[model samples]
Target: MLKIGSGAGFSGDRLEPAEVLLEHAELDYLVLECLAERTIALAQKEKFHEPEKGFDPHLEVRVRRLLPLLSNQKTRLITNMGAANPEAAATKIVEIAKELNISCKVAAVTGDDVFQVIETNHLLPNDNPQQVKKENLLSANVYLGAEALLPALETEADIIVTGRAADPSLFLAPQIHHFQWSMHDYEKLGKGTVVGHLLECGAQVSGGYFADPGKKEAADLADIGFPFAEIEEDEVVIKKVEGTGGVINLQTVKEQLLYEVHDPANYFTPDVTADFSKVEVKETGENQVQVTGGKGHERPDKLKVSIGYHAGFIGEGEISYAGANAEARAALAGSILEKRLSDKVPHLRIDYIGMSSLHRTSFGEHTPYEVRVRAAGHSDSEEVAALIGKETEALYTNGPAGGGGARKKITESIGVLSNYLSRDQVHPKLIIRSTDNETI
Candidate 1:
């Protein structure tokens, strides 16, 4: 059995749970997924100023902490921690390996950047041939598939870093090289992709974020354990560290299976088209569930590209009101802020945060002892954005009684626009710059 573990569900996940796996779990490969829909855009924004600052902020910490545990284990590390720059990340990993006096080869996979095509001809060649504009475009990256990572696996590299790879592709790549699974075998590849998808979110399927008060109870949630997939003869058993917190059941697994799925029958990827409509899942043991019945078709001809741009700014302010008629005071404060700053901004919004904030359409009933009135705006001008927060802060001194905890700020945001291009458009390759510089 080739055991693979999920070290992280997202970019800012808990570090301790992964550390526990590095210390105790017996595994072949440990995959860490830390990218999201707009995470790459945010990374691109950072890279705009400082060239080597776009990768995950926690890359060094994750690698440095896991080095000691790698001394006696066979688990090799795989992660898309290389957010915007894989070469820079690989350099940092080489430095860390030298610092710890550990000998390991690190490989970086690149060529996800589509700006190469846009910059030369100012237009794409396949499908979307519209003139590519360099005006507000921050980052243009093609979603590389599992096959793009095959060259790295064939090498003796201990650590593999990638940029802009599909979420499930990160987990499926290792299985292909280790199990000798054919890239054209859609059935096995599809089931493998399903296992990758189920385990991709780490604790999402292991009950970290699936617990309810009285309906579903998960024990030791405060110290929830990271999950792992045990694969043997084309079957997968999802389990977590023994004696750790969190529960894994049929419901938890089922919820995660359909978490981000738009359509099960036509789920498209560069590797294969997976169909999860009839995937059979059942609990086989404690914290262990068997999954099968995932079907697949031919690979897609095009790959999705995420194009990021600078989207204006958002300014927000929040203040609390407590005691008698708190809800009325909150309502009154919202009205006052709107009356003052209504015509000043483009997209001004007012809400009683504690009441009708979550579901904007639903006006909540039964007010409590306190409610927070929040006013916000989105604008291309920072001055206009800042006005929304400034007016709301005025309520602390000029409006409502017993209003406290006034807070205001402006946040820079990134906007993402995705489009599809042919698979031939993207050119992925492995850059072997392993740490051969031994300076202990």
Candidate 2:
């Protein structure tokens, strides 16, 4: 049986559960899907400040803990934690291994960055729902497929660090390495792709995000165990480390299966076009669910690129009102703030918490004792954006009764721009480094 587990769902996921998986699951490979569309963009911003600090902040911590287990040779690690600087991350991992007195190999995969291509080709945005400007682009990364991972695996590296890659490709690439599966074998590739999707979110398949009070509730969710997939040539069973919190049943598996999956019949990736239309999920045992019937087709010719650019500054403020007529006071405060900052800030959003904030609630139907009024605006001028929050805070003493806990913040916004590129356009680069803190 081939076993793989997810260590992270995002950049800031808890580290202990992943540590538990590394110590117990006896995994064949562990994938850390730490990069998101916005994550790499922010990393690029960091790169501007310092020459070698764009990788995941937790990279050193994770490597230090995993180095001991990695020396055992049965398990290897792969991650997209090297978000903006794979080579730098590789160097750091090797240095940590040296400090731990363990010998291992680290491979950094590169060439996913399409920043120069965006400038040279003047490529237009692809499927951009927001119609973001291509001219303001900061980071442009092509989502590399599983095939780009083949060379690094061939190097027999204990750890592989990548930049921006299709989430499933991180797990599928290792499967391709272990099974020695041909890229043309779409059926098994599709099955492997399903395995990747199920485990990528780390805790999502283990009931971390699932809870409906009485209708659905998982066990001991506080200590949610990271998820692992026990895969065979044809069958895949999802499970987690023993004696941990969270449940792994049909409900959890069903939710994770459809996550971020827009089309059930055609899910495109660089390696294969997976069809989850006929996939089946059934409980095989306690905290275990079996997956089957995933199909695939020819790979897509073009790969999707995620581009991030400056979207101006965002300033926000919030004030809470309590006691008598709190809901009414909160509404009045929002209206007043809007009127004050109306012309200064062209785009503003105001919402009353515990009232009709998220959606339309019955007006005065369920009077609440407390409500928070939040106002935010976006603009190119820092001063203009900051005025919205200042005016919101001014509502504390200027108008309304019982308005307290006023807080304000301003942040530079980095927005995402989606685009496509020809498969032939982006190329993959590989760099192998040894455990002695030396690059090869």
Candidate 3:
């Protein structure tokens, strides 16, 4: 059996859980699925400003902390923390290894950045052509598959860093590399993809996102553990480190299995069109769940591309009201800001935090002891966006008797859209660098 563990789920996930996995799990591979839709776009922006700093902001911290633990161990690391610049990320890792005197090989898988291939006149998936201007485009990255990672793995690199690789493909690559599974074996590929999907989100399947206080209580969630999978040709079992906080029973497994899956019968990925419709999960032992029956067909002809563009600026302001008639005061404050800024910021939104913020519809007549009034809007002009928070903060002395704790913020928003490119157009290349060698 091959054991693989997840070091992180998202860009800013806790680092301690990954440390636990490295210290105890004795994993054969550790995959960190960091990189999200807007994350790469933000990284691209950073790269535009500073060429050498487009990778994950926490790359140095993670590599500095985890590299030593992986030095003598057989465990290899794979991660998409490379974001907009995998080559730079690989170089940084090599530098960190040299600083710590640890000998290791690092491979960077590139060619996901397909900005040059995209045309300004190209149409988006469901939208019209050329809706986004070329000047406003931030980044365009193709989602690469398991095949792209194969060469990197074959290089015997201790660490493989990639840009915009499909989430499941990261886990499936290791399976294919170790087991020598045929690329055409759809059934096994689907099963391996299932394992990847389950363990990709780190602690989600092990009870981090599955927790509900009274309805579904997980043990010692404050110190939740990341998940790992033990896989063979015919079997897959999900488990976590012993004595670790969290549960990994059938319930958690079931929830995670369908986490972002839109269609059970046809989940489109860069690697394969996985079929999780017949997949089953059974709790065979404590903190262990056996998964089976996942299948797949041929992969898609066109790979999905995530395109990021400048989406203007967003400004928001919030003020709290407590005690009697708090809801009424908060509502009044929201109305005042709406009327004040509606002319300048046409697309304004006012919400009462304890009341109609989430659903946008009123709940009932029941009043809460505290309510927060928030005014937010998006505008092409930074000055217009700034007015939203400025007007809302004026409520402190302007009215609404108990108003307090006023806060405001303005941020440049990055909008993400989708497009498709022919799979043949994306050619992933591997560049291997080691602490022992100067050239890649």
Candidate 4:
């Protein structure tokens, strides 16, 4: 059986859970599935300012903590933490290894960044021309699949870092590499994808996101454990480290199996069009669930690409009100900002926290002890955006009564659009770096 564990789910997931898995899991591979849809776009913004610093902000901390544990074990690490720049991420990892005086090989899988090849007129998935002009485009990355990572695995690298790889593909790549599963074997590929999807979110399947107090009630959630999969030809069991806080059962497995899966029968991925409708999940033991019966058809001819572009600036300000009629006072404050910045800010949004912000409708009238008023505006010009926040903040003495905790800020907004590119257009390659040799 081949054992694989999930080290992280997203860019800012807790580090302690990963440390627990690396210390005790004794697995063959550990995959960290970072990189959300807009994360690369934000990383691209960072790269625009500093060439060498586009990767995950926590990459160094994660590598520094996990590398030593890997040195003494056979477990190889795989991660897409190289958000916008895998080459630089790998280089930084090599430097960290040298600082700790450890010997290891690191491979960076590139070719996901297709900004240069993309055209401004390319139609997006929504059938509209590119939303952002070519000059305003920040980043365009193709979602590479498990096959794109094959060469990096073959290099016998201790760690493989990539940019914009499909989430489940990171786990599926090692399965194909170790089992020597043929690319055409859609059945095994489908089963492997099921395993990848389950464990990709780290502790989600183990109870981090499953807790609902009385309804769900997962125990000791403060120290929840990440999940690992034990896969054989005929069986795949999901398990976690013993004595760790969390529960893995039929309920958790069922929830994660369908997480973000729009269509169970035709889940289109670059590697394969997986079919999970007939998949079976059974609780065989404590913290162990057996999964099977996943199938797949031919892979998609085109790959999904995420394009990032500058979406202008957003300025926001907030203030809190207390005592009787707090909601009325907050509402009046919002109205004041709206009228003041109506002409200057093109798109303005006002919200009353603890009131009508989330659902956009009030839940009957009840006097709240306190409420927060937030005013946000988006504009092409930063000066106009700043005006909304400034006017809202001015309400301290000019408009609202009993207002406190006033805060204001401005930020650049990035817009993302989905598009498709032919698989042939994306060519993934690996760059190897090791303590023994420089980058090659």
* Clash numbers, per candidate: 0, 1, 0, 0
Checking candidate 1 for backbone clashes, the offending pairs are none
- Location of the lowest summed lDDT over 10 successive residues in candidate 1: 124-133
Candidate that beats the other on TM-score, 2 or 4, i.e. the better one: 2
The Cα RMSD in angstroms, rounded to one decimal, for candidate 4 relative to the true structure is: 1.9
Q: In model 1, which runs have C-alpha deviations exceeding 4 angstroms? A: 118-134, 361-364, 437-440
- TM-scores of the candidates are 0.94, 0.96, 0.97, 0.95
Local accuracy by lDDT, each model: 0.83, 0.88, 0.90, 0.89
In candidate 1 the C-alpha lDDT for residue 160 amounts to 87
If candidate 2 were superposed on the true structure by all CA atoms, what would the RMSD be? 1.8
lDDT of 4: 0.89
For this target, which candidate reaches the highest TM-score against the unseen true structure?
3
Poorly placed runs, candidate 4 (over 4 Å): 120-126, 362-366
Cα deviation at 356, candidate 2, in Å, is: 2.7
Better of 2 and 3 by lDDT: 3
**Which tens-of-lDDT digit does each residue in 77-133 have in candidate 3?**
999999999999999999999999999899999999988787554544568353666
Give, for candidate 3, the lowest lDDT window spanning 10 residues.
121-130
